[model samples]
Structure formats: structure tokens, C-alpha cells
Target: MMEFTHTASFNGHCTTLPLSSNNVTLDPTVKDKWGRPALRTTFMNHPDDIATMKFFMERSMELMDAAGAIKKVGSYAENGQTGGVHLLGTCRMGNDPATSVVDRYNRSHDVPNLFMVDGGSMVTSGRGQPTMTIMALAFRAADHLIQAARRGEV
Candidate 1:
């Protein structure tokens, strides 16, 4: 005789607010083999993010119970998330150069003819995947670049 069993899992994601402390900066002491400064990343989830995670975890537990799960186990980060899958909001896009790295069109405020059309330019990560948003931004930046070139701006 043969037996079969099944298992399921769920994951929840929430948007995190922008914090001045969470950033990526050039390491003053560390350098790569090419002598360029290594990138240093610092991140910590906000209290609201932790609370949202807890809420989702509780909901998932209830769902499992309603599904008549024979056995269940669940856990969430009580303190905060140590790391994340999406790397976003590194080079924030805004109108002011003092507070942001890129402009509305993803062009570097300090560097001419340079564009940053990646997740780094995002001010915050969305609840869902960012691939489509990133692609849209890239397309928009490309079109802007094309128009600028036509006008001899690039």
C-alpha cells in the first residue's frame, strides 16, 4: 500500500517606510580589488512593518486552523527583519538634490547624461513584486533620453 500527504505555506509582504538611517554608503575603510570603495548597507524594518508581519502571521494561523491542518507551525521576526529580498530605495528619486540622488526622470542630479532606471531609484518597495514597475521606469527614462538627444540635450 502507498500513502500521500500534502503541505502548504504562505508568505506576506508589506511596504516599509523610508528611514534616514537605512542606507547604502561607500565604506571608508573597505575597498575592492580595483581600489574602489566597497558598498556598505544598513537596514532595519520599522515598527509598523513588524506589526504588519505579526498581523499577517496571525491571519495565516487562523486560515490553517480553518483548513483543519493536522499540525501547524508558524513564526515571525519579533524584533525586525534583518534582511530582505528586494533591494530598493538606495538612490531615492526626488526633485531636491540635497535629499535625493536621482531626479523624477531617473537622471542623476549631479551627473549629466547619466540615468539610473533601477530599483535603487524607488522611494519605497511595493507590497508586490517590483519587476513591472522597474521596467516601466526604465522605459520612461529611455524615452526621455531619446527626446533629450533629439533636442541636443544629451
Candidate 2:
């Protein structure tokens, strides 16, 4: 990333956003759940959340400089979503088999007994530290696979 270009080496770091109950900045003018309105998403990083990354990189560099430490900061040129990019996509939950490549279980809608998990199942990236959620999804998929195995879907 542009942030890492000027400083110290990375030591295997990763991050996820802190989702607060009041963080939603935009709403679809809809309401639900408790006789009130609701937002489809309360808060989100932009499609390309470069600003957030840039801010973090700046702060990191500032801190390192303040502490008299060497630092190199830059963004990864490839793209921003590398952390969560590998998970979901065409194989996620869908209303119809024709729409999604995978079923709710993330199984290949086209192939029997084959399932995928992780970022590969995501339709959109979350402004999250998705690993925990990704793990949960993987567990759920594994469970579904096991059940399917019991049912002899494999």
C-alpha cells in the first residue's frame, strides 16, 4: 500500500473495523424490528476504502516517528480488500439457483457435494475484521457438509 512505502517492515498485521450501534451515516428511509425505522447499513467503508487505510498509515507513521523508530508506509498497489477478498462471491446465499452459483450452504449449485467457504462466499466486502465471521461461516458450511454427508449428498 502507499502507506507502507516509506517505513518499517510489517510484522504480520491485520485489522477489522469497530462497529458501533450509532455508526450508520446513511439510511434507506425504512423502519423495522421495533415499530421504528431501520437502516440497511448503519456504517460502511467505501467501495474502495482507501481513505481509512491512508489514515491508519499516517497514524502509524506518526507514532513510529514520535517514538524515534524507523517506519515505511504505503498501500498495497494491487487492491485494498486483500484481507477479505478471498472469501465470498458467486456462491453465496440466493433466492434461486439460477441467480447464485451456490446454495445457502455455499455448496456448488452446479455440482453436487462440493462446497466452498471464506471470502469466496461474500457478495460484498464488509468494513469488518472478517476473519471471525469468516470462521463462523466456514463452521456453518462444514456443518452443512457433514449433514449432507449423513444424508449421502456426497
**RMSD (Å) per prediction:** 2.4, 11.9
lDDT of 1 by residue, 1-154 (tens): 3223567787877678788888889999999999999999878888988898899999999999999988787888888887678878888999999999999889999997899889999868758688899999999999999999999999
List model 2 lDDT by residue over 18-71, tens digit each: 323314333466667675667444434343345556666667667677878754
- C-alpha lDDT of all candidate models, in order: 0.86, 0.57
Candidate 1 stretches with Cα past 4 Å from truth are 1-4, 34-36
Instruction: Please give the TM-score that candidate 1 achieves against the real structure.
Output: 0.88
Q: Once model 1 is optimally superposed onto the true structure by TM-score, how far is the C-alpha of residue 47 displaced, in angstroms?
A: 1.7
Indicate which candidate wins on TM-score. 1
Could you tell me which 10 consecutive residues in candidate 2 have the lowest summed lDDT? 17-26
lDDT of 2 at 81: 45
Per-residue lDDT, model 2, residue 107, is 78
State in Å the error of residue 61, model 2: 15
